[model samples]
Each structure stands twice: as C-alpha cells, then as structure tokens.
Target: MAKLLALFAAGPLAALAAEPATVAPLTNSGIAGQLVQLLLGLGLVIGLIFLLAWLMRRVQQIGPRGGQVIKLVASQSLGPRDRLVLVQVGTEQILLGLTPGQITPLHVLKEPVPLADAEVATPEFAQRLMELLGKDQKDKP
Candidate 1:
C-alpha cells in the first residue's frame, strides 16, 4: 500500500522512498555543445523547407498534359499595380487589362498577331540614342 502511495506521489521516488535521493544529475557539456546542437536543428528545418518547395515545383511541372497551353505573349505596365497583357489561347489572341483586384477583357484580335522577335533585341531608347548621336552601331570602334 505504501509503494502504491509512493507511485502516486512521485515516479523515481517510488523505487526507494526511505533512503536519501540518489538520482544522477544531468551533465551540461557547455555552451559550444548547445550552440552546435541548436545550429544543426535549425539547418535541418531550413533544409526540409527547401526540399519540400523543390518537390512541389517538380510535381507541378508533371501536371495536366505537360503544361499550360495559354501563353503570355506580352505584358505592359500601366501603373504600379496595373498592367495590360496580351495572351494567346489556342488559335485566338486576347488583350486583357489587369488591375489590383480585377481582370478585364479589353479586346480580342480577329486574326492571330505574331509576336515580333526583333522587339526584344532592340529597345526604343537605344535606337533613339543612336539616331540623335548620328552613329550606326556597325561603325563602332
């Protein structure tokens, strides 16, 4: 009955209730050991987060007939949070106005408009600067 009473009172104390307490004290290996343990735990958590993100990206790439057929042909920013986007869907092309909270369809082209590859290579400012300076890029030193 005393053992049962001791068990209810305390866990390790139940073994020898009559004798002086003889439990071994926890040893501290010091600050360096604790810092190394803390860094390792943080590194593990960060590594797992990156691993999960990479896995999600891989899984998303393998979804629904490879990828999306709707292509963003071009985008022009109107304001800080507003944009005008030209999107190509299958055989049709659409001009969309995108705001902070709303997406409005502005126009739809009757014929498919091809995206000019040259537009990406030469910017408007460079062409204007060349014209003002009266110098051809081909005649560079």
Candidate 2:
C-alpha cells in the first residue's frame, strides 16, 4: 500500500519536472493585438445584426400576398397610453379602442369611406390654424 502511494506521488512529480524550461512572457503589444482582434470581431457581429435588421425592414415594406388589405384611416389619442383608431380592412371600416394591454373593436361603419375622400375630409385643425396665423403675421409685416 505504501509503495502504491509513493508511485502515485512520484508520477505527478515526474510530470511537473518534465515541464518546459522557458515560457514566453506576455507583452503589451500581444495584449493590444488580441484586444484589437476581439473588438474587430465584436464590430463585425454588430454590423451583421444591423444589416439583418435593415434587410428585414426592407422586406416588410414590400408587403404580403394580398397587398395592403388593412389601412389606418385615422387615430385619436384618448390618454397617455390609450387611443381610438379607425382602420379600413378591405371594404369595411372599423373603429378600434386601443389600450396598453388590449385592443377592442368598438364599431363598424355600414358604408365604407374611400381613402382619398377620407384624406380630403380630415384636415389638421392645428396645422390650419398655424398657417392662418403665419399668413396674418406676414400680411402685417
């Protein structure tokens, strides 16, 4: 049993003794080179991620098989995080109640309004007021 224990200890000691005499010391240039390589790799990964995101956005803009079936007609903010929206899906117009967690259909219009007519009818009141005020000020000058 003692001879077996001695053999086990000797085996590890012999392995340590056979280790290389010289080990290359780490230099500043080597560390800087590794850092540069690491940064370049990280930058490449980030660039690829951004490129993929941009490609996805471009693909999404091309749209689906049926073209744009759903169009947003108008949106009105009820609160900080709540809104009332009118959406035109195909030939139907739907009023939707939007909240942070839920979206509920409020009403559906019997007669669907045309997109061009809706755009012509809904003028921005604040923008019109601002334009009028600007015109009045210019006239006085």
- Give the per-residue lDDT of model 1 (tens digit) for 1-141: 999887788976655766786879778779999999999999999999999999999997787754678988989999999999999998899999999899999999998888785535458799789878998666755
CA-lDDT, candidates in order:
0.87, 0.85
What clash pairs does model 1 have? Answer: none
In Å, residue 85's CA in model 1 sits off its true spot by: 1.5
**lDDT string, candidate 2, 85-111, tens digits:** 999988899999999999999999998
Supply the global lDDT for candidate 1: 0.87
Mark the 10 consecutive residues where model 1 has the least summed lDDT.
Answer: 115-124
How well does each candidate superpose onto the true structure, as a TM-score? 0.56, 0.56
